[model samples]
Target: MKLLHTSLAALALAGFAGAALAQDPTEIRIQWYSDGIEGEVMQDLLDRFEEENPDIDVVLDNVAYQVIQEQLPIQLASGRGPDIARVTNLKEQAQHWLDLRPYLSDEQVAYWEENFGNRFDWMREDGSDAIPGFLTQLTMVGGFANATLFEQAGVEMPGDGATWDEWVEAAAQVMESQGTAAAFAIDRSGHRISGPNASFGANYIAEDGSPAPIDDGTMEFVTKLVNWTNEGLQLPDVWVSAAGTTYRSGADDFINAQIPLLYSGSWQVANLSTTIGDAFDWVAIGSPCGPAGCSGLAGGAALVAIEYTEHPEEVARVMDWLASEKIVREFSERTLFLPAHAGIVEEGGLEFQSDDPNVPPALDRFVQASGETLPLADQLPAWRWANAYYGALVTRISQAMAGEITLDQARELMDQDIADVVANANQ
Candidate 1:
């Protein structure tokens, strides 16, 4: 009787332990950063995903953009980071991303290949066919003008085919007439300037797949920008106010009505619409032309699974749910972002969830301008050394803007910096 009782208790304990283990859900963490309202929308969608997949738990770590740009790399190198991340610096860090081909069903993989295949190269290693991620939105670099400021100043906004010089000259007239701080300002980013550089015929990629030396085309725009800042025609605070490669936006200046023109990107659409409501009229003016052509860089943020993740199957489930055609359409609609899903983009007719009259036209303008991107500008997004070039440009150009170096000196430094990056990578 004593032996029977002891055996029965042990069996009960084992049964209880098994039940507890079975009830424990697999938890996966997603490191996310937001430029607009997408974070909130993502959480909501994730909540639904969890309700459906009760065995999996999704933890969203909402972080600053700087963390993604700077810290995430360090974490990834140490084999310690979130299971998934939303990142804009895709190509440079492609090796750390998980290939979902083995885990996802063939039909599902086909869907991803079909819809997001165009940008797979942008996020994957060269000559490697890894399904690392999908772009969340397709961003186009462009310009926006405060139309109310133009109207009040009695200066007509520069129309299509207007040169950068012409736009600056027009904005200068507005600044003078309205007593605004400066004419215009571009975001303090090397990537931001690359489009304008390409418009002047600057090609960063060399024939041997190496970084090209700074050319006359890059200098043309850089010189104009430097001269404009010194002349007080361009808002100096954005580039000169920050040291190193810290990003600063002229969006606030435009939002506060302190500047007439803001040369940023299409990602600002949702942000601008939300913040500048009924205060003034603004319009997307596309990219201002240069000697080569009017051009804007094409880029976007991608949601990628980390190769170091333990819960890859769960991560894939989350990625698939988020990347679904229905979810993609919904996310784009709610966030007012340009869809990266080919089906969503091809099917068209996304009724963006905004009553603002400016929203639709601005988005449409970006869609049209995306077609105008220069060939060189279009290729930069996928180039491995593109970030190296971008970083060097920002660092040296900002120094030039701050009177710490001459334009020629900055160009020399940028070339050397890029050469060092390539050399170190090879070594």
Candidate 2:
């Protein structure tokens, strides 16, 4: 009888332990990076999600953008990383993304297909039909002009159809009148210049998927850029300050009023509004025209599920909640980011949450300019080899800008660099 009683007690204890274990929620970690207010906004939404779904715990791991760019790839390649990551290098690292379709319900899959399906190509391998992820925000590369500087300098801001040359000349006038350090500056990035290159009728994609050789159209703008830098019209510190394709931005120069104009992207809207705040007026000028057309490249960051996640179902649940139409709309409105969801975009009426008068019009201008993108420029966002081309361009062009090589040398070297990337990728 004593032995039987002890056995019963042991069984009860085991049952109790099992029940406690079952009560514990599954934990999933999301590695996140922020450029502005989005991080705070996301955490608020996550808090609500946790309240609604008691069986799952979501941990938001905030890290630097450089971590996402450099370190995350290494982790993913090794089949170890956060369950989910927000990344801008979408195409290059698409292989490591988890396909949520198998885990998600039918209705959920249909909803994602309807809303974010079009952009799946940009973040997935070619010939793939997997639902890897969705873009967090859509970005358009464009220009911003300090309206106050233009006005103070009594230099007329370039009109809607102004060419790049005309805009440069106008900016130079402002620089002279305002006694600014430089006329204008572009972010020292190959991606930053691709839009302008496209505006000059350059197409970097070959008939196949490989990168095309540097063409006359590319040289037309690159030559002008190099010459302008040499002539002291373009800000030297932006391109010349960096070497070997290191990313640098002239945003500070623009915000500090050291330059009358800046070429960047729509992502800077929030940062600009918060930093500049009534210091001076500014306006996004869209992309200035070239001989071919006015064009800007389209790209964005995506929230992707990593393939190696232990809790795929939980990760899918978190993704679905965040990607719902209501959540997407709210996120966009609060963060002042352009929505990538087709349904939300078509529904319209995104009242950007910004007190600054400059914010809305700037966003509106990027939306307008996004439609102006050339066919070739539009193709680049989804192209796997686009980064290779961009990297080569920045490296060689910076060398040329710094007088380490001639423009012809830069052109030749760019072609060779792209060829090497293609060869290595094939192997």
Candidate 3:
């Protein structure tokens, strides 16, 4: 009779514990980064999500972009990273993502397949159909013209179908007239250079999916780049003053109105609008064309569910809520981020909002240019080995630009470095 009473008392305690556990909300942590005010916009939406779903709590960890780029793979590899992460190298890290298909209801799964199925290539392994995540911004690399500088210098802005040669000439005239230190300022990033490389007809990836950064087409871009730097047309301080994959932004020069032509991207729209209010008429222009075609790079970061999340269901819940058309539409506009949704993009473009009136037209130029990018440019960003390929390019090209190595030597090293990475990945 004493043992039976003890067993009954234990059972009673267990029942109470289970009831208390049921009332506890699941907490899902997000590893987030923001190029602009997107973090604030997302926080507002996340608060709304929590209000509706009382059993879930969302925590956003806004870390440095460098942390996401360098340290995230280490954390994710140890299976100790955040439940969700917003990342730029989507295909490079697709293996660590949690496929949300099984967690979704059959109807919801069907809807996802219908809407975002195609993009899963960037979120999957090889040909696997994994709905790992969706892009938060459809970003591209191009140039922004400080029109006030052009007008002040009495230099005509290069129009559509103008080649880089034409733009270079116009920029020279502007610099001579305005007495600016640099005629053209490019962000010290290989990603920024890759657009112009593609425009010159360089196929960044081989047919068999190998890295091939240097080709006849890319040589054209590299030659011009070196010439422009030496001739003082392109700022040497940003690219030549640094070496070994260092990032030096020319955004400051553009923001300071010291640069007439700044090679940046659509991602700068919101941040520049907020920071450069009424400073000048900044306009995003189409990428200057080349012999092959007018090419531009389209890429962005995605919010992905990590494979090691303890709260998979709750993570899916948050992602589903965030990926909804209405919410996505709102996020895009409020943050000035380009949406990746097909239907929404086709609904006459995003209703982009901004305090600065020039932002909308600048955004339109970027959007239109993105639409005109060559097929190869669109495909390269989703390549599984893009980060490796780009990293090698950055290192080698920066070395060349810094005069630590000749262009020929840099090209040779780039090819070798990328090949080694591909071989290791294959192994």
Candidate 4:
């Protein structure tokens, strides 16, 4: 009877241990944000991920961009941040990212290298081979035009080789004829501004990879922009109303059909397709030109693993699934985001689902439009000080546009700002 009781107790303990093991899933928390319908689409994919791997559960924390930019660094430094985060400041935050090499199997890492080697390299430490993340959207900034507005107003839309001046003139005619509030609107973003200026040949970063915000090429865009605000061609509230790095989105203005043209990008495709369905005839066009060439800025956000996470293996599992070609293709197609996957891009090109001819064509062109802009590759993008470089350029440039400072003065201040941030970082 004593032996029987001891055996029964041992069996009960084994049962309990098995149950505990079954319950202990590796939980991955993704700090996420959205410009449009990406959040919903991502959640669906994540649910599928959890379904396949019952031992893994993903928690999506849909937070504001401010939280990621402001609070995440502190949390990462304190080892309290989420397991994964979708971030735009990859260069800035590369220091706190997990290498993801050890956790990923040899074949798996090879898959990543094949699909996203260039982008993964973007997240690595300078001169070190490391892959910390993959791109969510390989964003190439461009413009959206209200063809319906132009048609109704009897204004002819400019085709390829149209300069920024010509586009604005066309937009002004449409705005005047249709009684729209503004000729053109753009999201008040440094990235947004930088895109058009690239056509003007502005290397906001100098040849030697130092902060050099303004040159004759850049001044051409800034000068025209300044004059446009004065002439009522460009609206003030979106760009000049805000000070510093504060983003004021002009999405509403463009979507509501108030602005004749919007200087936006591919990320807006899903939103425009779903929200503005049959309401307006709009199209994406080739980016405008200046003396240099017609080109746009290419950039995007990344899904990165936090280095301090306790579950690096689980993180790798989640990343592996997310970064897979099958999953990435679905994500990009569903969300209408441009993919950075080379094979997926090369094989069939992004199988994007959209009716508007402009959307698909623009995606293809944007993907092919690499090397169209001055590559930020050499030192600016590879360095940790990129955020500071961008921040200074954006803020001071905003001030200059608002007429608070001269462009030359803004350039000087930008130089100082970059120096201060770098100096402080070194200390």
Candidate 5:
């Protein structure tokens, strides 16, 4: 009888241990890219999430934007992907990720659709049963102008609905009159050109997941760009030589009153306000358009769940929280990006600018651009290949602009390079 009692006691102890093990908190790994401030904001939000759900542990794996593109696929294949990741384009998520449709319910879908419009379709795959992730912010339209330079030249600011031709002429007049300022400046590389390219209806790819050869629109775009550079409309060495001058330099040029206009994303608003606060008044203007009216490519990032995560539900919960109004508002206020949530923009009292008086008008121009038809780039199978293409295209165009090659030669080279990429990708 004593032996029997001992055995029963041991069994009870074993059962208790098993239950304790089952109740252990789940750990979720999250990966994201940061531009300094946004990283800190995300970390703070994650800390809040951890506090609210003590049963879950969140591990952040911060990576550079370029590095994340190269590392994610290999990590996923090796069974070491994060539970949640921030992806930039839909094609990457659709090709390599698990469909998130099962995780989002019909009610949640309806809520998102009703609030954000149909823009979320960019995150969906054509035939896949998944809704990959949610967009938290948008890069709105706004160009920086050198008010000091314009004032000195006695040139009136370009109108809100100015066409590209009008803008070029105005820029020339400004440069000729001011003598100190460059006519216009831009980062003619990577997605930096997406805004102007989209405005001109020149896209790198087609909608049906196929490569679209550069059409007449592309030729017109190149011609205009080359002509602009040759006509002394661009700063010397702006596109010809590889310098350390980035889009930020272009902004600085405007602030220091060296360049009359700098085309950049709306994310620069806060940084510009802080950097050049009251030094010389600056204004934000809408980007001039092609014959197709004003338009610009949508630029931002989205949060996606990996297919191999152990805690899919927890991942979804975090995404839901990030997409929530409170967190999004906080992020927008901190980062100066336009909130992805329509409700937040309407009711959140997000004052986009306190320093520059032109910010409100510039944001309104971005809204107008958003309303126009814009083409979305087809997703590349591997992000490395996409980056390679971008780099090569930029170099080729820069060379052409410098009179090293003709536009036809550049187009032919682009076609061959694209073909090689497609072949290698298929292999």
Candidate 6:
């Protein structure tokens, strides 16, 4: 009887151990770009995900922002891609991503479509079929103007519904009247031009999904830029400076009453606030409209799951949670980004306070502009190549502005640069 009892006890212990092993998840890996505060926020969110799903163990691999775009493809090809990754452009990674259409419920897809504009093109690559990943944020570009400078000049504030031409006239007037301050300033680098290039209706590649760089609108844009510069408007050298250099010098110029208007994205709001700290009032307005009403470039990071992952369902769950309204608000609030999710912005009730009295009107201008602008295409090759082309174009424009080249010469150079980029992207 004692031997039988011992045998039963040993068998029960073995069964319990097997059950525990079964409950443990086959490990999952996630990749993300990390910066100081955003990284910390992501880490906190990941911890929460792990806590809720005890069975799954998550391994996070943080890579530099620039490296991820080039490295992700190689890693995916090697069969060593993380179970999840934060992707920016879906068109680039569409071939590698598992089509999420099969995984998401019909109801979920409907909900996404209603709130987030159109999810069909955003989720699919090649514009046919295959949902690559979900969009978690809405990136926007607007005009950041130093309201204090305008007040000092005693210029009538720009109206919320002002057109691009009206804005240019106002800026030129300010520069002429105010000797020490520039009327308008922008980073001529690829990063800054993305928004304006889109506004100008320059498509680096053709709409038929082919590599075609020639566009008349592009030349018109160059002409407009040159004309603006010649109209007593200051085009600061700092606008064309290299990437990764802090915009602090330029922002400082604005705060110190040197530059009145700076064109940049919503992400700069926090940096501007911290750097200027209410010394003077500053406000952001939406990018002015072109022939096609206001069209601003939309860019932000997104989360994607790896094709090789054993737990695609589990990874999708985490992604869904991250894209939830609560998470969007948390991320946007912490990073000072315009919320990607539609309702969350209203729910979060984000408000900006400026020391300058003119800031309120400027904010209204931005809000109106944002409401009318359209998002840029998320196609990877086109987006990336356009950025390169725009950078070169800006440099050429800057040279023309400084009398180093004629407007015609700048246009020809830009045309050649665009042609080269489109060819390389096709190859």
Please, what are the lDDT tens digits per residue for candidate 5 over residues 1-427? 9999999999999999989877968888878886436777788888999889877878888888766767787787687778888877545455556455567678776665655544455555555445566666676544667777778778887777787777767767778897855688765554555456656766566565456676666567667877887877876456766621122236666656667887766666766776777777777676677765565555567777777887777777776667777777888777666777778766757765355665565565665555653544323322234444455566667778778889899887777777677787689
lDDT of 4 at 94: 81
Order of models, best lDDT first: 1, 2, 3, 4, 5, 6
Q: How do the candidates rank by TM-score, highest first?
A: 2, 1, 3, 4, 5, 6
Task: Between candidates 1 and 3, name the one with more favorable TM-score.
Answer: 1
Tens-digit per-residue lDDT, 254-282, candidate 4: 88998989887777777877778888888
Q: Which regions of candidate 5 deviate over 4 angstroms?
A: 1-25, 77-79, 104-106, 113-117, 176-181, 201-209, 236-238, 243-249, 345-349, 352-358, 374-392
Worst 10 residues of 2 by lDDT: 203-212
Model 3 misplaced stretches (Cα beyond 4 Å): 1-22
Better of 5 and 6 by TM-score: 5
Candidate 6 regions off by >4 Å?
A: 2-15, 18-27, 34-36, 59-63, 73-80, 105-117, 163-181, 189-216, 227-235, 239-258, 289-292, 308-310, 342-367, 374-405, 425-427
lDDT of candidate model 2 versus the reference: 0.93
Best by TM-score: 2
- Quote the lDDT for 252 in model 1: 94
Q: What are the runs in model 4 whose C-alpha is more than 4 Å off?
A: 1-17, 354-358, 376-385
Clashing pairs in 3: none
* C-alpha TM-scores of all predictions: 0.95, 0.96, 0.93, 0.92, 0.81, 0.76
Q: How do the residues 284-387 of candidate 3 rate in per-residue lDDT, one tens digit apiece?
A: 88688888776678888889999999988989999988988898899989988878887788786667777688888887888888877877787877787776
For each candidate, C-alpha RMSD in Å?
Answer: 2.8, 2.7, 3.8, 2.6, 4.8, 4.8
What's the true lDDT of residue 422 in model 5?
77
Q: Flag regions of model 1 displaced more than 4 Å.
A: 1-22
Better of 2 and 5 by TM-score: 2
On residues 79-196, what C-alpha lDDT tens digit does candidate 2 reach at each position?
Answer: 9999999999999999999999998899999999999999999999999988888899999999999999999999999889899999999999999998999899999999999999
Tens-place lDDT digits, model 1, residues 331-357: 999999999999998999999999999
